[model samples]
Target chain A: LAKTTQPISMDSYEGQEVNITCSHNNIATNDYITWYQQFPSQGPRFIIQGYKTKVTNEVASLFIPADRKSSTLSLPRVSLSDTAVYYCLVGIMDSSYKLIFGSGTRLLVRP
Target chain B: EPEVTQTPSHQVTQMGQEVILRCVPISNHLYFYWYRQILGQKVEFLVSFYNNEISEKSEIFDDQFSVERPDGSNFTLKIRSTKLEDSAMYFCASSEEDISGELFFGEGSRLTVL
Candidate 1:
């Protein structure tokens, strides 16, 4: 399991793009970067995942540099409802038993 | 989209009492997991189940905790003796494969021990 570091909190305006970066300097070669969003009192929901480079989905995009020491989660045109705690996890895909969630970045999408 | 479902959205129990939290995973999913979050704290992994048995468990999953898949669709977590420290929101989740993809999680079962 790779330990991750992220901002404790961030403020973003509605309709603006938000990017949360996570650092996993000790990330292993088999590790994949995964981001999950959790709303108040709700379980963490998967937002995006990528092994390397960039991967885009309907909800968000993940960008991993070649070094793989860090990754970024980009949310486009954010709304107030997008405010939530975002968790970045690094673990082996299909082999790891459980996801180790660290204190995540809390994004506040303000109007 | 298929989702995981948990029963008794909230539970209140006394110390030393046993409680069982139930979950119904997505119909086609093969992997199940249990996680808990103490109020104002980070989410912690308790255990993961696959092929009708436990694949991994955390240190938090002590002797007091156990997991079972009694039938085809239901996965359950049992706490033999509750403590005040056991109070937290218990979340059940399932994945189509292993960690290769996203996990579908239930709302959660909030357990309060007195």
Candidate 2:
């Protein structure tokens, strides 16, 4: 498992874009970058995942640099309901592999 | 959208008592997992099950913890002896393929051991 480092917390207002970066210096070749969003008293929900370059979905976009040493989760037009904890995980996509979560970045979307 | 479901939204038990938490994974998912989070702490992985057996488990999943898929639709976690330290939110999740796929998680079963 690759250890990830992220900001402890971030603040954003409605309609503004929020970007959270995660650093995984020890990322392996087979590892993929995955992000999850967790609301208060709820389970973590998958947001976006990517191996390299950029991947976008209905909720968020993931940008992986060429070196793959880091990744960023970009949320467009943030809202108060988007306030949650965001986790960045780096690991292999294998059945036996387990997800190791860190403290995660807490995004506080202010009104 | 499909989701995972867990029973006993909250449980209060005495130390040294046994407890069982149940889950119903998405109909098509093949991989199941158990995770726990202490209040104000990071989520911790406990175990993963596939093909009717455990594929991986963390050190926290010691002799006191066990997992079972009693039938086709239900998965369960058993704690033989609860401790005060066991108080936390236990989440059950399932993936369609492997860890690489999206994992749908349940609302979680909050355990309070006294």
List, for all models, the DockQ compared with the true complex: 0.56, 0.59
- Between which residue pairs do clashes occur in model 2? none
* Chain B TM-score, structure 1: 0.97
True-contact fraction per candidate equals: 0.52, 0.58
Q: What's the residue-level lDDT of B58 in candidate 2?
A: 83
lDDT of each residue in B1-114, candidate 1, tens digit only = 778999889999999999999999999999999999998877877998999899888879999999999999899999999999999999999988665646778999999999
10 residues in a row with least lDDT, candidate 2 chain A? A91-100
Backbone clash pairs for candidate 1 read none
Give candidate 1's error at residue A40 in angstroms: 1.0
| lDDT tens digits, residue span A9-63, model 2 | 9999999999999887776666678898999889899899898999999989999
Misplaced by over 4 Å in model 1 are A26-28, A92-97
Worst 10 residues of 1 chain B by lDDT: B95-104
Best-fitting candidate, measured by lDDT? Answer: 2
